[model samples]
Target: MLKLHFAPNSRAQRSLWLLEELGLPYELNRMEFNPKDLKSDEHKARHPLGRIPVLDDGDVSIFESGAIAEYILERHKNGGLKPAVDDPLYPEYLQWFHYCEGMVMPPVNTIVVHTLLLPPERQDETVRGQAQRLLTRALAPVNEAMEGREYILGDFSAVDTMLGHAIYMSNRLGCVTDEMTNLKAYVSRLETRPAFQKAMSA
Candidate 1:
């Protein structure tokens, strides 16, 4: 059986959302967001970094949400989250899928670390402001891309699953706002998905 080691509110939610979207039966090993919980010797065996959303498939183990999503999609023949290589949009789909972490999350993570995770003594106002601006700049193209488009590729794909989570966190951190009406609508659309709801609560 597929066993997913997850932590609520972490990037692990991405994997959980994907699993729910695919209607796959798997074990959810929910964990707390703390070193004592994830940084244990046992957990480290699965992920050297002890990150959440590590998928254990019998003898194989995988970490990284994007990798996990691809792993699951490649295994499920009925999974239509990715585009076929023959499809013209396949290249664009691949671009957006990886763009989630490559472009979007770094600044969002910086803001999150500065505003919420870091202790007051360690938090830097300068870093927070810089992250906010960087995040805004990074999101500018996404807003432009969403103009008159439903999804990144004119239809729902796994890229949405990856990008949606970043938008969700960005919204929470005020990185997304009403001025970006298209992005706001996009986030709202993602929020209403039943699988997304399940992952949010899971």
Candidate 2:
């Protein structure tokens, strides 16, 4: 059986949501969000960085939520969420899917580390401010693209989960505010998905 190493409110939610969307049965190896569970030698064996969202598929173990999502889609032959290689939307799909990690998360992670992860004494206002600004710039295009669209690619796809996770995290940091009407609506739409609700609660 497929097993997912997960922690609540982590990037693992992406994989969990995708799994639920695929309607596949998988084992959830829930763990606390702490060094004791994530940084342990046993967990490290599954993921070199000892991060959450490690997927163990029989003898194969993989990390990185994006990679794991792709693996699941490919392994399960569920192409519904992904555009075919020959499809024109394929490039756009790849772009937005990767944009979540490559473009958005850097600033989001920076803000998270500076504002939430680190102790108040160790947090730096300058860094947090810079990250917030960068996050704003990163999300502007996303908000614009979401105008008149229910999903990133105009249809419900895995790109939603990939980019949705980043948007969700940014919202938690107060980055997605009322002015960003499209994003706020987009989030509301995503939250309405049964799969998204299942993944979040899980």
Candidate 3:
């Protein structure tokens, strides 16, 4: 059985959602975020960066939420979490899957840095405004792409799980607006999924 090192309300939640969606039986090794604990040491061994959501499947070990999502989808290709490789929507899946990590995360990280990581006195107003502006601009393309589509690939795929984090975080950060109607609706649609609800409540 797979062993997943995770914490609730973290990126690990996405992996848990994927496991639930696939109906895969896995052990959830919940780790507490203690700076001075054996579990923290073990977690560091599993993930050099000491991040949550590390997957250990026998000899295989992986980290990073997007990579973990893709790995699970690939491992269970028929699980319906991912489109077939030959499917026309596969390209969109691949694009948006990477975009969630590459494009969206940069601005989101900037927001995190400016809003929380930096001290109020040292926080640069210009940097915060620039990050907000960039996030607003970057979100437009996602909003347009999701217009009239129930999901990023026009079907529920790993892209939804990947992009879901961005949409949810953006909403939490007040980055989402009426202009992102499609994206907001997309997030709402995802929230209705049983797996997503389970993950959220877990």
Candidate 4:
């Protein structure tokens, strides 16, 4: 069985959601983000940066939300949460899968760093505004792309799990609005999924 190291209200939400969607039997080892807890050598061994959402599958250990999502999807492609490699939509599926990390995360990270992670004395107004603007711009294409579709590939797949997290973050940052109607509806649709609800409540 898979062993997942996770914590609530963190990136680990994505991993948990994926596991639930795949119907994979996995052990959830919950960790709290305390100085003493994260400082332990064991935790550091799982994640050099002491991040949550690490997956220990027997002898194989993995970190990073995007990597974990991909790993799970690939390992269980027959579970119906992923597109087959030869499917016509496979290329777009792979592209959007990676886009969650490559395109969406940078601006999100900037927002986190500028708004919450940095000390008040070190926070830069210019950086915050720039990050907000860039994040908005980066997400505009997604809104446009989703205008006619209920999901990224027009069918549910791991891509939805990936982008749903970004959409959640955007909503939290007050970056979503009626102008992003399709994107907003997409998120709402995802929230209605049983797996997503389970992950959130877990």
Candidate 5:
């Protein structure tokens, strides 16, 4: 059986959602989202950075949600979540799958650090504002792409699981503004997914 080291309200939720979507039986090693729990030697052994969403499958251990999601799909024959390499959509799939972490999450994480992670006195509103602007700019293309599309690739795929988390995080941080109607609608569609709901509850 697969085993996952998870923490609530962390990127690990993406892995959990993937597992649920795949209906794969796995062990959940839930941990606290704090240094005492994540920074311990035991946890560090699984991930040098002590990050959540570390997956253990027999002798194979891996970290990072994007890699984990791909690992799961590759092992499970894409689990109907990935486009076949021969298919033309495969290239686009790969782009959007990585885009969540590469383009969107940078600013989203910046906002998180400046707004939630940093101490109140140390938190910089200026930094947060800049991140908000960057986030808006980063999502503009996505908003445009979302026009007349329900999902990133016009079908719910693993990419949605990854991007959904970033969008959800941005929304929670108030970085998702009212003018982002397309994104707001996209969020609504993602929120209605049972897999997304189950993951969020975790």
Candidate 6:
């Protein structure tokens, strides 16, 4: 059985969602989000950075949601979630999968750091403004890509689980809007998934 170290409202949610989607039985080692819990020496042994998602499978351990998602799909043989290389959209799938973390999350992280996460004295308005602008620009392409499609690759995939978290962060920060109708609808669709709901509120 897999052992997942989880913290509510963290990247570990993505891994939990993936596990639920895969219907894989695992132990959820829920932990507090506070530094005392995450920064403990025991936690640091699993992850040098003491991150929320540290998956212990037998003798091997994995961290980072993207890598963990891929690991699950590869082990479970769920090609629908992650298409094989022979598939036409395989390249595109990899692109969007990586895009979620690479393009989307950086500014989202910046916005989060400047806005709610950081203390008033540490927050920077200039950085916030710049990140907001960059995040908006980053979303415009996703909005356009999502036009006439329910999902990124026109079918549900693991990439959505990866990127959806970033979009959720954007939405929570008021980055999503009515003008981005397609993106909003995309998020709405993701929200309706039972696995998503479970991971979020479970």
Q: What is the C-alpha lDDT of each candidate?
A: 0.87, 0.90, 0.80, 0.82, 0.87, 0.87
Q: How accurate is candidate 5 locally (lDDT)?
A: 0.87
Residues 1-202 of candidate 2 have per-residue lDDT tens digits of 9999999889999999998988889999999889999999999988888898999999898899999989998887567689999999899899889889988999999998998799999999999999999999899999998889889988899999999879988988999968899999888889899999988888
Model 2, runs deviating above 4 Å: none
Best by TM-score: 2
TM-score of each: 0.96, 0.96, 0.89, 0.92, 0.96, 0.96
lDDT score, candidate 4:
0.82
lDDT of 6 by residue, 61-120 (tens): 999888888888887655648888899989989988888888989999898788878899
The predicted structure with the larger lDDT, 4 or 5, is 5
3 or 6: which has the higher lDDT? 6
Cα-based lDDT at residue 162, candidate 3: 73
Q: Which 10 consecutive residues of model 2 have the lowest summed lDDT?
A: 72-81
Candidate with top lDDT is 2
Q: What is the lDDT of residue 82 in candidate 3?
A: 74
Cα lDDT of model 1 by residue, 172-191, tens digit: 89989679999999988888
lDDT of 2: 0.90
Q: Which digits, one per residue and each the tens of the lDDT, describe model 5 over residues 1-202?
A: 9999999889999999988887889999999999999999999999998998899999899999999998999886554788888878788888878888898899988888887789999999898888899998888888887789888888888888898778888888887889989889999888888888988887
TM-score, predicted candidate 2 vs. hidden true structure: 0.96
Residue pairs clashing in model 1 are none
Q: Worst ten-residue run, lDDT, model 5? A: 75-84
